[model samples]
Target: MSMQDTLDTASRKLLERAAPGRVDFENLVVVPLFAVVAALILGALTMLATSVEPATIGRSYLALLQGSVGSLAAISETLTAAAPLILAGLGLALGFRAGLFNIGAEGQILMGGMAAVICGFSFSHLPFAVLMPLCVISGGAAGAFYASIAGWLRAATGAHEVITTIMLNMISYRLVDYMLRLPWVQRPGRADPISQSVPPNAELPALLQWLDPNLRLHAGIFLTLLAVVVVYWLLFRTKLGFEFRASGASPEAARYAGMRASLIIVLAMATAGMLAGLAGANQVLGVLGRASPGFSAGIGFDAIAVALLGRSHPVGVLFAGLLFGALEAGGRQMQVDAGVSIDLIGIIQALIIVFIAAPLLVRALFPWGFRRPDSGDGRS
Candidate 1:
């Protein structure tokens, strides 16, 4: 071919590669789906190896499925569990998109929850509409402020976020413990670490109490869904998101483009912290109704896995959170109904992560799974 023709062909290929919606479908969708399947298969094998009878194994799996989605109560539990995970995972995913590893969500969640709970009990006389929003805003703002400390440290002192956030987590735990022990913060007449119960008006209203008062599902799920939408828009439809993506992809190039690195780092961390704080607030206001030691329930740590499983995408985080929530809700049923250990669910989750991390291994096992018939580049 002539030199001009060769240049034109190269330009067309570059444009095609850069076009929107051109993400690799196999890696994005198929890999994760198959990883789940693989994990389930391995979990079943684990049961057999542990001397579980084949029939009992089948029953355990059946109970798991039923408990997650078979009945109204099951669906409610799944949604209730999913709401917090989705919120926290969205925060972590946002950090991932900005090339930052924010591991202090545990501290942020604790701070946020405590802030909301304090708001809840202190303003018991306020109307629901006024008090609820006030508590939520306080939770988010507290989390943002606490997280910004780490961000500012990283920006100004050249400190690594991983180290700073971990230290913050430890500090937060002690700080929360101290707060809960104070005479004014602790529940009156109770010596335990628990805070006073939030007023009824401050609680997140149950979404399905009229249909079944036993359901724990609440309006927080709607907020979680709204956060998903907002994060999606923030990541894909905003100029700030472009800067974040650019910085993550190539810090040198972003700097050359005149984007302020320190500002982006601090803002990204603050945004992630805000979401995490909201998750904590949701738990306190929507479910727990108070703050205590471990009130965050390690949701912050689980959020890392959720963000990874979701490939750091907002929509993906939503679905991944729901799946993890189903596993949690169903694991209880499996244990109660079939006498299976709840640890089995943990094994499955670990296996899924392993498979997801090793896509080449999955592709090797299913060589034809991701190949396109007409495309010779070896991807669908």
Candidate 2:
């Protein structure tokens, strides 16, 4: 064929190739949103199937909104829940960026809270000036160390992080339970597993106490924002960040490019663990003010949904966390107001993941409502 004719064929092929990736991208973005909408619709259907009216779900949904964000006190409670979610989800999201799935946020959180409690109760003489930072740092460090074990295993052996991290989560629960049962940690003569209240100095400053004691929003929200910024910087700016991302994208390619893949893996896990631990610490400092049995209430698991729903973007994760927090905090009112099943939230979460994971299905269904990505390479 003539060179000109060959070029024409190549260009046509390139255009065809480009169409799919572009369609896929649009599909990805639109599918998840549609999935959420579909999930809610499914939930309504479920309500009807269970002998509850579809209006029961919507009625409770509205009440849940009112209880979570309606008044000043409600808004504060929402923020309070959002704070820890922001921290924990960011941690999990970072791990995802580095191709590491550090699923031990629960344990990391427990250790962080336990460490914060230890610092708070022990440093009774320290002024709020010193005590708060001390609690924060100690909590983060405790979580980091706890996560390092899984990192070490991944680096040294071919062990998958999902397994080790999950195992560690269980261990952390038992360890924290044992520690809280100690006479020094537990309140004297208290039959409960709860620790003593953190010193008032260790408590985070509430943002709007003037509104009401029920307005439990605290300065930890600021800390969560700081964490998001810092994670964003580390992922895109510094050389170390580049190494972490490179390893995550392709470990072999990173090694070929002379990057330390193993080290990056360990650091990524450590960083993720630290964030999760800080979340736990926030629980203690901002809301709980003490560690107890089942303190996290499965926030770690909920954080996974937050990360996936946000596509692992820092800003996206923050908003997703808040949304989940709203759903969680509002669930109580949903149950109370409309007598709807609390399981509806989980139903929605599952549906969102399903749509996100298989976006093609969504695009097939929402033909006019979505889009896809593009790739321009051509060689047939």
Candidate 3:
């Protein structure tokens, strides 16, 4: 071949290899952020429709900020909220990366919480050294086992995870309803569905010791951050991460390369479930001090939103969890201080997800509403 031809061929190979990753990264960053920005706009419009005063949004938001961080107690509560969200969001992101949607996190949380409570209450005379690890493992195992069913179905039969996970979620609610009230699981002589509190030594320590005792923030937030770093490392810096992404994007291509697609699906769900279980364990051992119905507070579902908002990246999920935690902590204040319906929070969340997933719809509609589609509303 001619020297010029050889040089051109080499340059083209390098260019192809270099360009896609950079362009892909840009898409990853912008799409999710744009979704969030659009959601806020839609949320603001919703508030205006409700006839809320202009300053009310500002006042409520400030109050929320004060509650979330201005004081020790608020900060504690904010961290507590973020703890479960981080774990749950990580779980969802993992599943997404493996082309599975483990929507059954709520159920997994239930089982994990139940497992932790059982370990905490049943075990006697154990030192804190053993007790903590025991609780963590048992909880994660419970969630892993719960999620495995959906994974098994997907592996065995081409079952769509979306359907299986949702079905399992329903089944989990019923199972929890039955188990929390069991003679062994329930609080003695009480009709309430709460379980006995975790042992004091078994509880996680609050990391911000400088904060006043009035604060409720525990060590769980640090752990959640740790999980984020680990997930990022796993997803981007490791061979397993590569396999997970490849399997997710194209199963056939993965099979062509001799990757074990089914095994990856099972292992991926197991990993995701383990994180979710840890969230359940955190609620019991750190924040709630016991198992309670609705302890997760739909954080599992919210994690999906967080994963989407964060573009399923670990760093994105952490920030997304914190943002949602802040919104949740502030939302009550928004309602009480501004008389805005708490329902508005739900509306805002839905709008954010909708707008983020479909920004083109907003851009196009607004313009016609801006240029082409505004055809006199089909009127004369």
Per-residue lDDT of 49 in model 3: 83
Span of ten consecutive residues with least summed lDDT in model 1:
371-380
Candidate 3 wrongly placed segments (more than 4 Å)? 1-31, 69-72, 208-210, 359-380
lDDT of each: 0.90, 0.81, 0.79
* Cand. 2 TM to true fold: 0.90
Instruction: List TM-scores for all candidates, in order.
Output: 0.93, 0.90, 0.86
List model 1 lDDT by residue over 1-380, tens digit each.
99977876776566447642443567778888888989999999999999999998999999999999989999999999999899989999999998989998899999999999999999999999999999998998888888889999999998999999999999999999999999989999888888999999999899899998899999999999999999999999999998888888898899999999999999999999999999999999999998989999889988888899899999889989999999999989999999999999999988988888898877776677765322534232
Expressed as tens digits, the lDDT of each residue in 120-175 for candidate 2 is 98897899999998999899998888888899899999699999989998988888
lDDT of candidate 3 over 19-134, digit per residue (tens): 66643453455555565566766777777787877788777656766766666666667777888988889989988988887798888888888898789888836888888778
* Model 2: CA > 4 A from native: 1-29, 372-380
lDDT for residue 7 in candidate 2, whole number 0-100: 77
- Backbone clash count for every predicted candidate, in the order shown: 0, 12, 4
**What does the lDDT read for residue 105 in candidate 2?**
84
Clashing pairs in 1: none
How far residue 286's Cα lies from its native spot in candidate 2, in Å, is 0.8
